[model samples]
Target: MASSRGGGSQQVIRTGDMEKMSLDQLKAVKEQADIEVNLLQDSLNNIRAATGRLENASAALHDLSLRPQGKKMLVPLTASLYVPGTLDDADKVLVDVGTGYFVEKTMAEGKDYCERKINLLKSNFDQLIEVASKKKTLADEAGLILQAKLKQSSPSS
Candidate 1:
């Protein structure tokens, strides 16, 4: 098969010649496909985690915006510590804009920001899933081709 290369380069590999190739060449194609699938899977996993976080953040922002001002609540200073505090101004909140940067925003504004972030993350997750699916299909196809070549070379029918 002819494959296009970068910089106007062209590579011509005849699939008919697979039977003539050494065992190593067939194995190499399978190995390369496996690596591609693995890398894409890792990227998909990370995107999934980010998507979950954005979903949770958006939900929390929405819930916080519904509370009354000066409502008594336990503020979480850490994952395990919840200090007694009150919502001095339910209409105001601190939002992390990313990269360790934060800004004060009204509760409504914060909810909007979280929603936007969630939408962007969802889009990214969809794109990543598509790519990962394609990579996995490629890997499976390569493995099948390799198996066929091996059977063709074997003495047994």
Candidate 2:
């Protein structure tokens, strides 16, 4: 069987084709399949990271919205340290608009923005998961085919 990946169409080795390929050809095909799996894994990792970030942002915004206005709280100066600060207005927040830009929005608007961004990130994450699963299935099939071919050629068998 064959699959059309982006850029061009490529042949996938089936049980029948695997029986005809030389040992070297089988190894080459296996290597290509491994590469595809690796690329898909990298993409999945990136999406996972983005999803985590969006979730964290959403949590922070929600927590901020619940805090009392004019209350002094510890603001995170670093991962391990927080400086004392006062919440002048729980009604507003600073939001990162990407490309090193930030925008001010009301707390309600900020929550809405977080919800929208989280939804977008989740959608991308789901797509990446689907692609990665397909690539992994392809890699596993290729590995099985290669193993069967190797076994057929073994003298002990």
Candidate 3:
């Protein structure tokens, strides 16, 4: 089968037509499928990284909830810098929602937000896995057909 994917639209030609396509057309199909597979893989990796970060944030929140107010701790300003500071409030925290926006939320609300986001990312990851699997299968089929065509055209010893 030949698949043309454009603007979220997929046009699949029947398998019978693929048998009639020239070598160049088969090669093109294989290449396009390969590109799509790579893109999906990158997306999967990014989702995994984001999920890990959320999990880490949840853990940090749990740890913070344990510390009493006025407890001395080193607050991180960057990867390599931290300043000594005393905890001012134990129940309230600033949550970075996104895009340079921070919102104030209680500890419980912050944890709930993290949980919701984690769940959403996991659901999207699963759906993307299904799509990536289908695209991979299509790429493999295109590759096999291309190889067969190549073998048929070459001289046999």
Encode model 1's per-residue lDDT on 44-150: one tens digit a residue: 67767876876787787778778888889899776699999988887788887879898999877888887787787677667656655655565566566678877
By lDDT, rank the candidates, best first. 3, 2, 1
User: lDDT per residue, candidate 2, 53-122, as tens digits?
Assistant: 8678878988988888888999986679999999998887888889989899997888788788878767
**Least well predicted 10-residue stretch by lDDT in candidate 1:** 1-10
| lDDT (tens digit, per residue) of candidate 3 on 1-157 | 0122221577764556667889999888778878887877788888899999999989999999999999999998876999999999979988889999999999999999999999998997887788778777777877788789899999998
Model 3, position 15, has a per-residue lDDT of 58
- State each model's CA lDDT, in order: 0.68, 0.72, 0.83
What's the C-alpha lDDT at position 104 in model 2?
99
The candidate with the higher TM-score, 1 or 2, is 1
What TM-score fits each model? Answer: 0.77, 0.76, 0.90
Return the candidate ranking by TM-score, descending: 3, 1, 2
Q: Candidate 3: minimum summed lDDT over ten consecutive residues — where?
A: 1-10
List residue ranges in candidate 1 displaced over 4 A. 1-22
Per-residue error for 74 in candidate 3, Å, reads: 1.2
Model 3, runs deviating above 4 Å: 1-8, 13-17
lDDT of 3: 0.83
